[model samples]
Target: MNPSQNEVLTPSQLIFIVNGLLIGVGILILPNSLVKITQQDACISTAIGAVYPLYICLIITYISKKHPNHNILFLSKKYLGNFMGSIMNLLFLIPFIFIIFTVTPSITNILRIYSAEFLSPFKLIIIITGVCLYTAYNGINLIGEICKIIFYVSLPLIILPLFAVQKSSILNLLPVFGSGFNNILKGSIETLYSYTGLELVLLIYPYVNDKKKIKNSLLKGIFLTTLIYVWCVFITVYYFGLDLTSKSLWPVLSASEIIDIPIINSFRYLFMLSWTLILLRCITIYCFIAVYILKDFMKKTDTKKIYFFIYPILVFLSTFFTNEITRRNFLVKVTPIMVIFLVIYVSFIALLVRIKG
Candidate 1:
């Protein structure tokens, strides 16, 4: 397991993995949150929020292509020495575990509220965590293959909105700035968490087959993801009105629920089905990243050996938070810190490599 320096995944496979991870159950909550950040120019704000991450993808892929064989862990350790590298690596790893524990409870609450009113969140949490942990234990290469399966589930997840367009009123967005242009950018940027999964490239680039294709795939990914997100936001805004869209947690699902289909019955159920894949993919991708980072640090042994130890830590830590609101609050507080680390982490590493070269 000496870094698996030769394991390189294709850019198409990487695109699916990143897309599957980014498009998650959060799609349901964003409309409401964006509105709260202030009922603004929904379409423009959503579109702008989508663009920021695309640029971020460019920066990461450029550096990763230049140093295709090295991961952030190696770069941090190399330039800053093991002590500083280990600290940053540990902080990075903390977010993954924190996310796992946080998101399971949140999805559990969603399932409880909308799908199964009586099911136990604890049981659902265990089952979801078990599947993700199993995939993660297999190592990075296998994880990429599983991502292909995730892509299939996600195909409809992206396309299902077309059926709802007929029912949407173009007039709802008439003023274009019900809340003003500046507020639109302000609100949408706050909800930019939609693009969180792009960072996975830092871990997976070391395994991509053609590092050059990584940038192209990232561009396609950000573009595709932004389009889907903007459409979802627009649909939510158009169908429900800013006030209602802002109020509902699952706005897209709610919008679909009310629209009538001729022969087919429940579009809401389809929305839920798509979201299940979203939830599973999100958790699994991050779990894979966390496990890989752990393997890199444990540097002395095979990742397969260390993975078993990692699963128990996830199970134990997840028990502290039992509700969605609390978990989301935790995610909000920690994510900005993670972003800052990534900025510093990616920049310092790139600078070090340039100096070394």
Candidate 2:
């Protein structure tokens, strides 16, 4: 269904959207990257990385309160002027596009590895992108509702790790700071890339129905995301220790493999199936934002037509990184750059708003 252009999200919907965007494929593999950097202190890095989102949320709240009707697109043009602001707005659009490119391949590869080996990468990409396109076509309000449902449905899956905790040793988490302060800080920077979605708040701010509650809703969302990331890293480290967690590509999935459920023979498959919905939501949200930004630039274009134009390109580009190593390497190089750029971009915009006021 085509939502009205004036569609507005409630604070709870805002909370769920933030959580939905933050949780994605990052949770599945973050422990591996963190453990590689900080060893057993990976959870600490995960917790520290949360400060990035917290900072972004503060900036969003400040800017949104100051200019409730203006999204980053218009605000940039207003403060930075037509030429520079348009450049900045175009630059702002890149990360969302990168997310779609990187995550589309990553999620498809993940499903292939865990469950859908029979399916070709292109087929998987098409299926996933098709669902996302449909959702994006319906607009942000539907995406918000979907996020709320997926949040409630998939949250209980976090507890699945506890079933495997019996095999974990608290000793695995000992010598926590043994990774050293510098390494832990570096790990925090690396994990900070996983929090990419928080920047979308700037774009979505104008759509929030209860502007007064955006601050609290954003904080609630970021806190929930941080809690889950820390738990995933902590559990992975606790269960597999530094050596195994660092070596494993998808450490969380590896951790899930060990859970013994009487009803289900392989909890890993169940876990993968459940998270597939979460991953879909993550991609859909990014796709929607990308389309939304593009529509902002081309006001006369229908959003659904934009989706049709974009999906084929997403499908084709996604094929380039179907290999696991290629996909991981691309994201590793690209995501950090995107994160750093976003941080600087938003901070500069916030400063501009404050000064011009």
RMSD vs true structure, all candidates: 2.6, 2.0
| Alpha carbon lDDT of each predicted model | 0.71, 0.87
Instruction: Tell how far residue 27 is off in model 2, in angstroms.
Output: 1.7
> Best candidate per lDDT, number?
2
lDDT score for residue 156 of model 2: 80
Task: List the lowest-lDDT window of 10 residues for candidate 1.
Answer: 1-10
Error of 2 at 309 (Å): 0.9
> 1-357, model 1: which lDDT tens digit per residue?
134643546788777777766677667777777766556466677777766567568667766866778777777787889999889888767756666777666667767777877778777677778888787666666666777776676667456666767776777777767787678778766655666667667766777777678888887777777777777877788788877887676787777776666655776676676677677777887887887787766779877667678766776667566666676687678777766666566666667777875
User: Residue 50 error for model 2, in Å?
Assistant: 0.7
Off by over 4 Å in 2: 1-6, 263-265
TM-score of each: 0.90, 0.96
lDDT (0-100) at residue 183 of candidate 1? 84
Per-candidate clashes come to 6, 0
